[model samples]
Structure formats: structure tokens, C-alpha cells
Target: MDPAAGLTDVRAASPTTGDDLVTLDGVAKTYTTATGTTQALSPTSLAIRRGEFLSVVGPSGCGKSTLLTMISGLVPPTAGEVRIDGELVDRPYRHCGIAFQTSVLLEWRSVLDNVLLQFEMRGIDPAPHRDKAVALLDSLGLEGSSRLYPRELSGGMKQRVSIARALIHDPSLLLMDEPFSAVDALTRDQLSMDLQQVCMDRGRDLTVLFITHHIEEAVFLGDRVLVMTPRPGRIAEVIDIDLPRPRRLEDAGREKQAAYAAHIRETFSRVGVYRRNQHEGGQA
Candidate 1:
């Protein structure tokens, strides 16, 4: 019997619901370097339902970022296709928001100015969206910090600013790549909960694809957690999270959450995420 089986079942999605916002049909990616051809992603098929918070968890080099980049239309897959809202994504998709691992904020720009850069980049006047920018910052818990410079904020706060910037345009889809990985555990917990609330505020129209290596975070944030195999990645298993909303980090030991974490950790070990030959060299 498979361990991931009977665990919320990966939904058997698409073909029936017909409401998927993103579809990966036999999508795959490969790279040819001086060394040789490297398969970053294997042929895969999946569907992302509209308004769902899908968390993809994997160790480094598992093609997590590769999958995201393909969805963003930043790079074309070497095989198959990626479609968002039924349209082929041949170029960068304009209607979605993408937040990279680093905050990437400009030191010279004020927090509010940074949030408004999205408009500036699109040749739209930032003046008209200043109010929206402020509200987005406020919503993300950066209230009264709008005029503060990026250098003055903490790492977690800077990430919040990046979230604000990505969201100011009311994007239908949001893609986040380890946005909170740099923060201390306490701050990461706060940001995780805050993100859930923000997505809730965005209602049923907003879909989020969050990537992380943290098992707990994936379980806390995802409607369904897509587990991946190591490099040349493909779906290993997917576990659905049926816990009630407004998840609390304080409930770390809660049975269901602990179960999800444990199972995923098992999946990690089973998939060679922790190589048999490797050992921890650092002291706690």
C-alpha cells in the first residue's frame, strides 16, 4: 500500500471540474550545458483549481523553482505545455504576481514607492495607485511603515513589502518562492498566518502557488501539498490538508498537523531527500 494513498487523494482534478486556473499537460524541462543534457523536470500533468492555495514542497534542486518558472511563462518547457486560464503561456504572463525568494527591494525607494513600482514597470502612472499601495502594505501588516526605506526594515518586514508589491495590482494568481525562508522561526510563523489571512481577504478569486522546503509550512498553507522527487523532479505524492481555516502555529503538536508533517518527512526520506551517505556536520 502506498503511504500517500487515501490521504485526501490529490483530488483527481481537472477533466471533471473544468475550473482549473492553471494546467500542466505533459510539461517537462531540460537544460543543455557544456557538461551534457540535464532534465530539470520530467513529463508531468497537473491541474490547479482556481482560488486554491497549492503548496509545493521539496528539497533544493528538486525542480521546485523550475516548475514555478515554467508556470510563470518565464521559460518555455522543453516538452509539453503550460496553460493559464486555457491560454498558452509562451511569454511572461502579465496578469499574475510573482515573489522571488529575496525581497529584491530597492534601497532608494520608500516602502510605498517600492509597492508602486509594479505600475511604473507597466507604463502606468504610480500616482493613481498610491492609495492601493498603502492599503496593501497596511493589509500585510506593514502599516505606518510605507514611508520607511527598505534598509530600515527587518528581513521579515522587507518580505512583507515584497508581498505588498506583488499584490497591489489585484492579481488573479500569486506565485511565491520561499518568501519567508530567511526569517527566524517566530517571524516565519507570523508571516505564514498573515499570508493565510491576506489570501482569505482576497476571497475566492485569488489562487496562490507557494513553494517551500518546510513541511509544516506547506501543511499549514496549502489546500493540497504537492510533494516532488529529487532532481529531474516529478510529483512524488500529494497530501490534502483538510484542517479548518485560520491555522495556528501554536498548535504545532496538533494531531493532524503533526501527522501531515510526519508523513511528508517520511516521504522526503523515502525519496532520498536525505542521502544515506550524508550526515549533519554542524552542532546544534
Candidate 2:
């Protein structure tokens, strides 16, 4: 069976309901560098429905990361409003969870302790949420390593712990920025499967906004793929992943998966955005 079989089951059981959770209205972000003000993202609008897994993909420096940071309220947009469930997200919110490329776990904390750190910082009692933390670790296959430090775990394991921490708060929205990029191919697949089940088990009803450069990974996890253009990024296209839910790794869904990736690659090529980094000798 494909490692992602569990996510499919979750998708099947959770009949999609509810209204939009995150809505971006004419949102634009600009950075003022020494070189003068640069527009990272043009005015754009989009909505993320509750329980939807939305992935944003673009060529390097297309501002996919910028969009995520705005959603997380890390950076305020130069223009436009970012709303969560109709409330303007002008500052950090306690009901949100975030994870990124690095696990960002405290080196001094044990895996379980790291997962509980959020609660401690928020002045929440760890005792009450301890079981939830343990269960999250076990669900992600990190049960035996609860006492291990960040350095003691593998790249994939570290990422898993980060995920557990994000979900530990039981937040309504999950923001992930290239969370799986640091892991190997095999481990990435495994972790992706684990995430599918995690979201399903809680019926997280999460509005997940993920940033990824990998087309395949985006295709595998997202219900819709938002493609962007080069710097001064704007939404070039939004492609629906028509592949049926409950996708498997083998022939169960490979052909459809490949087609979606190919289509995205072709679109990138058409916009002259794919090979920009190789030619420019820089990371976008």
C-alpha cells in the first residue's frame, strides 16, 4: 500500500463543511531594502476553506514564503488585509500553529518537552496537556524518543516532533513553510503519510497553508495548488488537483500524480520561471 493511504481514509471520512477560515483580500507585501522598496507580492486575493490543505508553489523567489509569513502574521502586508475566520489578523494569534523548514526545537529540551514548550510559554499548564503531547508524539511514530534531545533525532524525526508541537495546541489553522524539505526522499514520503493521518484523526478542520518548491510533494498533499510568477510575485494560476483522494504510491495513482506535476512544470516553463536560479546563480 502507498504510505499515504491513511490520509485518503481521513479525507473520505471528513465530509468537507464550514466556511472559509483564512481570506486574503487584495493582499500585497513590499520590503524596503537599501536598494529601494521592492514589491515581493502583488495585490492578490484568495481564501482557504476550513479543513482545506492548500499548497503554494512557484519558481524560486516567487514570494511563496512571503505569503506564508503574512498568513502567520510574522510580517505585515504593505497593503490588503489578512483575516482569520472574519477577524482581521493584525497581530499574532494564540489559536494558530506554525512549523517551518527547520524544526526549530530548543536544543536543550527533550522531544516531548519541546512539544510542550508552547504551553509553558503561554503559561498553560503542561500537566493537563501532557497526555495530548504524548499522544501526538506516538501518532507521529516518535513515542520511544520522547526523552531524546533535538540532536539525538534523525532529520525526519526532528520534523515529526515539530509537527507534533504545532498540533499540540490544537490550533484551528496550521502554517507550514517547507517543513519537509530537509528530509530525504523516503522519509519525506513517510512523514507526509503521517501528517495525513494526524489531520484526519483530529478532524483538524484545519486551514493549512503550506509552502513548497517540490511539485510532487505539493501535488500529493494539497487539494489545490497555487502557482506564482517571478519576483514581484503574483498568482499565475490556481490548479485543482483532480486526482481522487486516498492516493497511493504505486499504480493506484502514479499516472495522475505525474500528470499534475508535469502540468505544473510546464506552466512554470511557459512563464520562464523554472530555470531562473540556475542561470542567475542565486537562490530565489
Candidate 3:
């Protein structure tokens, strides 16, 4: 199953769809430093379908984070627009949640309090959401650790807490930036499976935009993987993963998964992004 077959250049692809949860219209970003100005992202356009798991892979400093920030409305684009559910996004949306490479948990707060932080920030009463918070922790395998502080938990446990916090509000979209990159390989694999299960359990209402450097992780987690060029990034290719659902790393489609990863790597090579020093070298 060649994921890249029958697809035109990403810009030439369909720009809008009835199911689109996110639409980027010629969005571009530029940063001005004390020295001068730098273009972090090229003018790029694409649509993310509702409930879709979209993974973005690229070499370091390729504006992958910039793209995510634009979608989250944390930073305004220098040109064009970002729309969520057909509404133009000009500010950070309350319906979106984000997690990053680090757990960023407060050592003083218990896991339960940390999970409830989202509600607190939004001025929502935490008492009514406590049960929901507990369930989220349990769902992420942090049931017994809710009363424990961050310093008392393992790295994986802390990350699970972070995930629980992100979902406590039940956001429409979740943006994860290398969430599993800091964990051990075994822990990373488990986190990936747990995340997949989270998406499945939440059904089609929850969409995810995941950014990682690992090609294998991108293919395994994304419904369609978007590959990007180097600095001043632009879409190089978008590969539709034709693998079956409820995907497990140990599934029988190991060969197919490898092929998908290979296709992404080949695309990266062609775009001059696969050099030795650029590779991150991990399952992620």
C-alpha cells in the first residue's frame, strides 16, 4: 500500500471540506530578531478533517512548532489566516488543549489538583468536575497516583498526569508536541498505545495534531502523515496511512508500517532533510 499514490502537491489538493475542523489559508510566519528578520514558515495551506489524527514530521528548526502554534492561535501568523470550525482564529481558543515534550507538572500539587487545573484557569467550579478528573486519571492509568505529588511519580507517570490534565476539559482538539520524546523506549511505546486508545475511546469528536521527529511514530499514529521541508518549511508530501484501525505496534502489519516509514524517509531524503546529523534516531 503506497500511501503517497494518487495525491497531488499538497497546495493543489482540496482546500476545504464539509468535515474540516481546521483550515489553514496561505498561513505564514516570520520572526524578527535583534539582528534582522527570519522567515520561520513559508506560506502553507491545508485542511485537517474533524476527528483526524494528523502527524507532522520534519528535521529540527523546520518550523514544525511554528505551524502548531499557528493552529493553536498562540501566535498570530504574519500573513493569511487560521480557521477552526469555519471561524477565523485570532486568539487562543478555549476548546483546544496542548501538551509538550516535558510534563511541566508542578511539584507542589497532587495529581488530582494538577488535572483539575484546566477548570480552575477557566473559572469553572472544580467540585463538579472532580469525578470526571478522577476518571480521566484512571483511564490514563494514573488512578493510584492522583494523591501523589509530581516528585513522587516516575517519568512516565508524570507524563500520564500531563495527558490527563489536557483532557480534563474535554477539548475539541489536542496538540501534542513530542509528548513521548523524553521517556524511555518501553515507556514511549506504551504511551503511544495509550494515546491511540484515548483517541478511539473519545470517538470522532476529538482531533489531534501531533508533532514528532520520528517517522515510525508518525505513521503509526497519524491517519495521514504530513512531511515538511527544512527551515521556512512547506509541505513536501502528505501520505495517507492505509493501515487498519485500533493499530497496535505488535500488529501483523509490521511490514506495512515499515513501508510507510520508508516512504516518509525517502520523501525526507529527496527534500535534503535526511542527513546524518539531522536524524533524531529513536522510536519516539
Report each candidate's C-alpha RMSD, comma-separated, in the order given: 3.9, 7.2, 4.2
> Model 2 — TM-score against the truth?
0.88
As for model 1, its CA RMSD to the true structure in angstroms is 3.9
For all candidates in order, the CA lDDT equals 0.87, 0.80, 0.87
| TM-score, candidate number 1 | 0.93
Residue-level lDDT for 125 in candidate 3: 87
Q: Candidate 1's residue-wise lDDT over 81-199, tens digit each?
A: 99999999999999999888899999999999999999999999999899888888888888899999998999999999999888888899999999999999999999999999999
Residue lDDT tens for model 2, 42-124: 88787787887888898777788889888888789999989887889888766878999999999999998999998999998
Cα lDDT tens digits, model 3, 1-284, are 45445434767543566998999989999999999999999888999988989999999989999999999999999998999999999999779888989999988889999989899899988989988889889999887778999999989999999999988898999999989999998898898999999999987889999999988889889998888899989888887888878997875246888888888877887787856553666422
TM-score of 3: 0.93
What residue pairs are clashing in model 1? none
- Candidate with better TM-score, 2 vs 3: 3
Q: TM-scores for all candidates?
A: 0.93, 0.88, 0.93
Native-referenced Cα lDDT, model 3: 0.87
Better of 1 and 2 by TM-score: 1
| Weakest ten-residue segment in model 1 by summed lDDT | 7-16
